[model samples]
Target: MLVSKYFKLNRSQATLDFLDIHIDKDIPVFVDPTSLRSLKTEWGHHCVSLLQNYFSCVLSAIRKGDDERAKTLLSCLNERNEFHLGYSKKKSRGHALGPASADEIWKSLSKSKAATTGLLTDLEDAVLFVDGVGPDMLSDAVCNIIRGPLIEYTQNACLYYEIPMEKEVSSGPVWNAHLERWEQSLIELPLARGAPIILIPKVVVRAKQSYNSNEYYRHYLMPVLQKHHKDTNSSLVHVLKGKKNKGEKRVYKTDLYELYGADKLASAKLTVAHPSALTNYRDAKKSTQAPPLDHTALAKLENIPNPDFPALLNEATKLRPGSKDAYLYEDAIEKFISGFLYPSLSFPVKQDGIHDGRKRIDITYVNSAKSGFFEWLSRHYAASHIFVECKNYGKEVGNPEVDQLAGRFSPSRGQVGILIARSVADKNLLLQRCKDTAADGRGFIIFLDDIDLRELIGQRYDVISGDSNHLLYKRFKALIS
Candidate 1:
């Protein structure tokens, strides 16, 4: 009975009698070689992407307004869909208002009057503008139907991004009416605090037949298993499971999923410390239920006794609790750019991340050569600085971080918003660069190291406020000024 609870197909007589339900004759089911039932349609893949964006927008507060504030946000959402401006190329940029990325578009939508979960039930009016659709079709329409309102509610409902109040996705007020309840939950967690999180199914049952087999197991299944090894060197079954469980441990890898009855795993006993535990803690399925079954489900997995690198780092530091070092961001930026940019640039660097919170400065010097930094400065004024940041814990150094930090824009601060990495990855700066806020990537972040920074020991000149807005370079004011 326990085995049959897991969504399975009945192919045999005994198995059929286990539950005394003859599904084979009454309800015909088709199974491919992999043995798992296929979803209603493949539309799930495309639509799910759009829906995830909507949910994320609603769940985050740092990015509060969506569909509400900015008129240009509509253009950003058009990227993933065949959505058009319905006008000529000349008119395309007309809708290109202030919204930056899809996320930012969500923020603008959140502020709209129509951004609510209840509003989603009104599928008719909303569907008119949607690209392709009918009552029954294999289109991304369903996603759009639910998305518009979610964005509305995110702006209208959620006080913060991370703490959502709704229990689950269904047709109800929890998605809309309970917005205030959701807002209060963010006191502890926030959207800016989000790190990489994922949910991985521990066990899978493949259906029979080439199409179902290849589609279900290979398409959806293998990729996740492969992902388990992205940062590690071992296979899912090998390194992930740790020790062995040869006792009454039930195995489901088989030719026919009939091995599992309808009541099998669908209602199996919670198995914490079994073989379904979330790993790297990134895959945990947390909940606010009075008694969270998901957490109990997570306990099912028997974690490998030990893991190296990040796991070791996690144990040693248990980081991400409070604030992070203000200067650690520079290291990540250097590492990322070293491999990312085409024909990337390189340089020697140092860190001064740790602080006593005693009004210590974030940066001291950069290669003040009158050539790259100072040369441009001399042409205009007298300045020598490439990228320097001041990691302020308060509001924002708005100008310095946004203007000269990133180096991407003509007159950007520091050329990057390099936030100091304390326990979190990049807690200092928000990802999107809001032009309304600051142009050159929001308050460019740069983290200090454990030791005092001494990257540029001896430089010819000093940083000077350059020709404010150089045509092609930054104008620095010489320190000798």
Candidate 2:
């Protein structure tokens, strides 16, 4: 009665489905709070403390007419400028007042009472005195320095911290940009760019009303204060609340303990725990050990054939010339891989290219197999992830196609990839190019054609019977080698 059936889930869809379930169920994800806290302390609080201390010393030296000591302190500030705080506009370069410009600013500051002035005011004056510079640039730099660590800290909090929700978690953006945007928008306000923003999820704060407010406070805000209380002891806690005017927002100020109070601050504690962390937490926690993957289950998946393979292939071939259904081909290839190969693979994340936005990889697999031919290949190539590119063109894939997949390979992203095409007319030539790339240490590329795909799919009956000799994986290994 059923006309046809297709492979059910692709790597990308599977990952999203998993995340959706996890979030919807309100599963607790954990992060290494200690390491994250240390990083925050170093970058967010300690960095600011050192800057303020150096600035105070510089001011003291200048006031006593000790130019040499003042210059020395100024030099210390210049040295710290190496870790500039602006966005990377061109590769690694950012808009920061370099050592030379910093010296110029310090020289001007020393000539006036600006050295003794408020930190933000002094920095603003220096920026104004410098030619061809603006507050935006300086603000970006300062905020980047302070907020950079906080961003990482906030990410950890969001990943691990649990908030009780009555309804299913909304399918929204992974990160609640409310805090990030609020902190960034502060630069445009009367506050300094280096102002610290405590990242408390709106959900957690709102949930405080449902239960004991102290529980929420002890769980969320206490760790932050314990790590950073010294540096920000006298600093006010700034919370961004409702809009002030059209396209503008207001920051509500409060004391450190006023929001939750210091009653249970000391007793509030968090420890590293499992099943309360992001999926990636396991990868981080066990750097040496590969995350567990059900090899038996994945192997069993190959036994199931998509009855609609013939129909799907026919439909693929009949696709109109220059049809926008290129994505259809992508989906087909993804399905083929899932059914014919491993089922534990992770993604072609919704965002085309998870790493580089400019380029989009057709398919990506986080080699999740523990022990198998694919796992062996992963270990051989030292790749934790594998990239696949599918081209449904009526003609043979060329050098440019090979180059595209090769370009995506990197040590971090696994220096191996696969190219799936309708056919490669000049098979020998294409293989030669792949060999050249491998010889050049660029990456290893395995080319798969329509016939190869069908062969793999056709063997499902044998695989299901446990009689097939894993010819698909063997052939792939031979081709790559």
Cα misplacement distance, residue 252 of candidate 2 (Å): 71
In angstroms, the error of model 1 at 246 is: 16
Cα deviation at 314, candidate 2, in Å, is 5.6
Candidate with the greatest lDDT versus the true structure: 2
lDDT of each: 0.25, 0.43
In terms of lDDT, the poorest run of 10 residues in model 1 is 196-205
Off by over 4 Å in 1: 1-142, 149-252, 261-481
Query: Taking the tens digit of each residue's C-alpha lDDT, what string does model 1 give over 144-252?
Result: 2233333332332223112233332222111222232111121211111122111111111111112211232333333443444443444223333435543222222
lDDT of 2 by residue, 180-217 (tens): 11122211111012222223111111100111224433
Best by TM-score: 2
For all predictions, the C-alpha RMSD in Å is: 26.4, 20.8
lDDT of 2 at 312: 48
In candidate 2, position 191 carries an lDDT of 9
Q: Give the true-structure RMSD of model 2.
A: 20.8
| TM-scores, one per candidate | 0.18, 0.38
